[model samples]
Target: MAPPTTTNSWQHPSPHLTRVDAFRRQVNRRYGLSLETYHELLRWSVTELEAFCRELWTFCGVVCSAPPERVAGPDDGALDRMWPRPNWFPGARLNFTENMLAAGLAAHPDAVAVSACREGGAAWRHLTWARLRDETARYAAALRSLGVGQGDRVAVVTTNSVEALLVLLACGSVGAIMSSTASDMGAKGILERYLQIRPKVLFVESRVVYNGKTHDHREKLGGVVAQLRKAVAELEVVIDVSGSSWSDGRIKSLDNFLDVRTESLRFAQVPFDHPIYILYSSGTTGPPKCIVHGGGSALLQQKKDFILGFDLGPDSTYYQYTTTGWMMWNYLISALSLGARIVLYDGSPLYPSPDYQVQLLQEQGVTHYGTSPKFLAALKQAGIKNMPPLDSLQMTLSTGAPLSAEIFEWFRSIFPSKVGLVSATGGTDLVAGIIGGSPLLPVHHGELPAPSLGMAVEIWDANGKNIEDTGEKGDLVITKPFFSMPITFWGEGGEEKYRKAYFDTFPGVWHHGDFVRKIVKTQGYEVLGRSDGVLNPGGVRFGAAELYGIVDQFSEVQDCIAVGQRRKLDADEQVLLFLKVKTPPLSDGLRDRIRTTIRKQLSSRHVPAHILEVQDIPYTMNGKRIENLVKDVVCGRTAKVGGTAANPESLEEYEKFVDLPLVQSSAKL
Candidate 1:
């Protein structure tokens, strides 16, 4: 992949940034606290934050302390040299299920935890903590009856239903590692991922609804499950949660799964490093690294993020726009530790109407509303000019991609100015944010502040040189280990490949694949974009990958590839795309779709608002379509193209048009 430039993306706002002075003024007006006083409240020493973190752990019921026996060589501090690498509760040993069970949800009695959201455009049904916990234990009993043990892996393909969340917790309680994907992924998408991590028991949902349409998993599940059974002999029972027919193991009510375990709860015990979940990234080659996070790490880090980062307390109610496939789903559910009510929507955020989310925000009294920048931009362009007052709202966290200045300004001007617009970034890799906006700081336009507490963050150049003194951009890197970082990748030869993935680049430091500036801007240093996918147009930096993800959902074309082509003589870039059409050839109608999609789905910056159509789209062997490679050829520059094509080996197919006159003009760099 080529390094980033702003051709495909960038905020048009001038470089006039709010440095330290202006930031201090915004703080005083909003919080009734000056920057100095607020800094006192926010400033944390390593020792102090560690203490607070432990308190959070205790509150969340996670029991981790250094084992009494001094395990030689790999002791707590000696385990590794990296920062934040699975700092387990150093002195205690406890079961994962026990912590969640001790949540004391009984006092809240009728307080809702898991609320079932059906795609039938129907109202939601809230599950009380009492009912939620009972159901979870019941599922645990059922899985145990099916012989699920502490070390086995239970795989699931599901939607964001109460059942899926309950099942994951159930697996954790019983010591069975949980791995799953959203029901919306296609056959190849699901199959390629599931095949790598052979789950012992498979849970498949029959169907899920998005927008106004319903999609069934029957076609893919049958073939996919068949293949999974072939790989893992331990694969025995199956649970179908879709509420539809076509099952392998006697159709079990997701509700009934809990019924079989009528006895008093029986939780299991495992090591601190026991695997909990297997999350995947959108990479092609070498087996989708099944990122394995530990039970201890997941619980503690989650508690830290919810309580500290977002100011989520026991009384707070939370909801984020997410699906089962996204990491936010996992993060959202963990907030249950705070005893806060979590509102889940299974259908598209804009399904039925664009006003759906605003309605939820007002009705649910959602204190922490997390969503993507794309969604907010869509709301703006869709003429959703006004919204129900979020009187009870405390924070609005935006992730999934960078928040453009226009989208950010819209919130400041049109949305609730009292509430903070927290643009946070963390991926499935760390299971937490490297740098996220905290309530303690003022929200700036299109930038984030300091790293989450305890995250030892630094930015490094290609040769592993640290970019100090703030304001300089470089590859975002983590200097030390912290809890919640993936312990390993499943199905790998060993930790060898896992280590190679993040460590090989900068030797000992963990090189996170993001191009960021460690600027001591108003708040602090923040990450910029995917270092590998940043689009450079002139001198601006933009995240092209995020731009594509937001723009593709516009429905103007079936799919699109946005790449910034570099010209030798010019100091700028030309943005191009290889689009696949579901409708007819490029016409005014199609162009309108492209423009509207970007404007409605994202801000004008992402619209590409300029596009091109190519006969064939080139992709890597693993199905990842490469945009940088195409851009390289589009600039009339020689690329690795001269070599054997990665996938669709028909290099000739690309050459036929890669240097074509029509294409050249469309993407003249």
Candidate 2:
């Protein structure tokens, strides 16, 4: 890999004092070996997988009713034992909610466990650990009275509020699996997912506040519950969180749903692989797939990432801006395992003021902040400047999409010099980060610091040969399974569908679908883009991120999406680049400059055949550009524009480009 430029390197202020360094010392003393560097520790983690997991389990203080006899699977083979679906800590018994509550209460029962607020609402409402435990106890008792028990599914459609967190914990306390989606999602999208799981109880928010609007979902909720009751005979109860009166007699308000007669909490100690969460695949191109995750694996892996990777502790305050729809919400919830205070916001960060989130960071004294590249770019676009130092903010993590080098510099330019900017990559498939930050590593521009420990991450060519050392872009694959792999998919033929989705691409290895390369010099990785959406024009393949990074430098472009288009009758694929500009009428001068910069920075092959301007770019609910969906539209294919899209109507504008004269001429026989 080429060396990081002088401007690209951001050195860590204090490496030795980091939690990873402290862990390294513990590892050295216990293992009777000297592993000096972060890279060396990472190597030992993947190679001695069992030892590393055992160490991590003890270090994180995982609260369990019964400890496992061994850290590896029961078959005594950590690798090649049923391959991808193998279990970890086979004989262990634990309760997910118990662990989180224990850690929180152990720190201090009176401390704030959650601080939540809404857009255009009153000041933050703090929920102490004692109050959180009480709420969970009451909810669990109510669930039990409703016949919810071990293995039952409880679904929630709510905002990122204290009530949602309480419902999740209550479900975990009873060993009932929990699945949730944000209230902003249309009823159809919500039904499509909940229908597959057939949850026993449903929790729906009556009102939602977003983008400076209060959306009342009374009619929508009635229609959804009516449909769900008809289809799912097992779905017996509906609870309204916002206390709005509903016409359906089956719906009960939060005050009415709770069992006032009961007060104590009882945690169900189930097996190690007991299912706790059911997440869905982003169904941009098709129906969303339901993925089930286990309690033990989710607890161990996420705690490792939060405590070790981000160096979070009991005194730290973590604020991850997310909705219930995204996996980051689950990751954020896991912060409680460290007894750390967490901030939960339900509406747009841009509302009230442009720098509202920055102000929250300073006010909350957040030690770790989780966000995306889009928000940072918006700050720069809004001309936000001269931010005072936040002495409490230690690290800022960006993950929804790839963070550009310019954004990295922009973060450095705005934040305090001591704050480390982490550009990490992971997805919903695992419900955790595969490659993220480490306090011991330097922040290189446009690169993630390292692969998460015990992930066994590597880059593989089309033939499944490891090419990570070659410094060549390839598929990001996991040669060995880690703790957080999904336990199973939720319904009929689910296992087959799951296998086909991930393992079918490369047989046994976990194909993560990201196009990336290893920066050998810095021991970091540059995530190019999704491998499936790679653009191939003239038989030369490259990631759209390469083109986007250059085009983003242009002041005229506000947002963009690059995709390859090939009609059914066409022999060759052509590249189409769409731009959303700040000003109207994209001038020829700006287009020529964009093309010139792309051609100069990248090869001519990387340049798009058509540079068109559009009013908006389609994005998923999670803030990812819908490139594949756009590709389908421009190629004249019928696309399934589902509720996963944040703005599905934006797809209509791309249909006009199907029969462009240049594109028609470029199509070879």
Candidate 3:
């Protein structure tokens, strides 16, 4: 396939004045190299990682007590372990929270650090840098009073508010690992994640409001507390952020829990690879994997992404619509390191109305607005044609799923031309993107602008051969260990589990499980959905995104999912397309148009064997489609609905197709 012609929609007026270009010039001068362009600088970064990382650390002005003796440790002479997991910044000692607050406290103590809003609220509340630091200090003192120290786990069940940020900062300051999930998660889901880490202290919200509805979690909290106390012998206390009048003796209000003293805020300096956060997998298929991330690594990688990838600064207002459960929420908090004001919204993006959300973005003067494809699709379906001119809005980011070309083009038509629409692909496993947009690159129609700096990204076929330049779809693999790679998995056999998850298929490469294609001409990447969910028919494999890209162009289709179904007697897997129409009923004419459009745009093998309209499509709690789970049910396998599924009942609609009869004859359109 040929790459689409690129257009220069957004570019720096003066190349030398851009932030990345300036960084490149500085690196060239320091290293005595003649790198000319941004692409050349990226090549240098991946090839000469030691010098690049050392320069980046100094450029970001990381607050460290002591610098590393060397960038990376010497190779241990193990072939399989050489590139898979390289030790970075050995003998360095720093605290994540200290680095985050250093710039803000020193330069902008009175500036607004966080702006937040609750569901259906009319006003936004601001938290200044001084207040953030003071509150975090108080929380740290409180945790210390409870004997929370290094390597301990502190779990939170809360909303996206200032309180969540405070808890994360406090835990990171004391070297305690922080993990949190949104209030909407069921008790089972919450336990499945927290139980693995066995947190010593738990933070809970008494109540949460979403879509203009208040949900009381008192009874659910009681059950969880009882179960956790029995399961984890180390559990000591539970803190309530809402100050609810609960009768439980173990629960304490926020005011009572804080043990304010005359001591100043102290940061516990730990090793470079010390665990600071424990992020969980989606847990749609089975139990969620507890992946631990290093403090120094997460800080450096996220700062690089925010500073260079998004061009965030002290004056920039960063807003990412995320709950505590998603990795994007963690990424959003990293903006504090740059002293950028972060916006937190705790509600459905489509609540009240799509226009209401748009108005909030414009009114907040959001410079970097992070969002998802579903939100954009909803806005397009609602016929929202006009929006207020957002002069401050520079970029709009989309993740969690693939963004179709139809919606991308539609969004481009409605949004300001200067605002670059960036579609990035990453996961909880890496804590950052492998391929994303850059401030210096031009935005393509439906492709990520470039691979992230310092990441050796490649597309490999089934035989572990690079196929990126050939324009063929294959597994997304990182050829070298990156800064944000998980330190380890929790519990017994942690090393084995970590190795099996990413390094089992390829001996030393990190298989990210995403099926992707690179456009050779444009040098952009297209993430076709997950590799495990790839559909195979007549020995040709393709991702579900290819089918959805074609069918989404129709105005009548609201949303859809494509899966592969193969029973015991079938020789080849059959492609099944399920649609949730905007109207009550889908007409036969629309089905024919869908089939014909797919066959014309893609190949005949891409056409679905059956096109059926359904009431709804299943998605994970993080808003990712459950294609692999649906495929299991349609292939005569028992699908165990997990806590991560947002709407598990939607899977029952596809169970009837398990015994579907094979087509007697191929019908020609």
Q: Give the range where candidate 3 is weakest over 10 consecutive residues by summed lDDT.
A: 1-10
- What candidate 2 gets wrong by more than 4 Å, as runs, is 1-6, 81-84, 662-669
User: Residue-wise lDDT of candidate 1 within 197-252, one digit each (tens)?
Assistant: 76777787887777888777687778777777777677777778766765455545
Off by over 4 Å in 3: 1-15, 74-84, 121-123, 664-669
How well does candidate 2 score on lDDT at residue 43?
A: 95
Better of 2 and 3 by TM-score: 2
Question: What lDDT does candidate 2 reach at residue 123?
Answer: 55
Residue 574's lDDT within candidate 2 is: 89
Q: Where is model 2 poorest over a 10-residue stretch in terms of lDDT?
A: 660-669
After the best TM-score superposition of candidate 1, give how far the Cα of residue 646 lies from its true spot, in angstroms: 21
Q: Between candidates 2 and 3, name the one with more favorable lDDT.
A: 2
lDDT of 3 by residue, 462-488 (tens): 999999999999999987667888988
Ranking, TM-score, top scorer first: 2, 3, 1
Highest TM-score, which number? 2
Q: What TM-score against the true fold does each predicted structure earn?
A: 0.78, 0.97, 0.96
Q: In terms of lDDT, which candidate is strongest?
A: 2
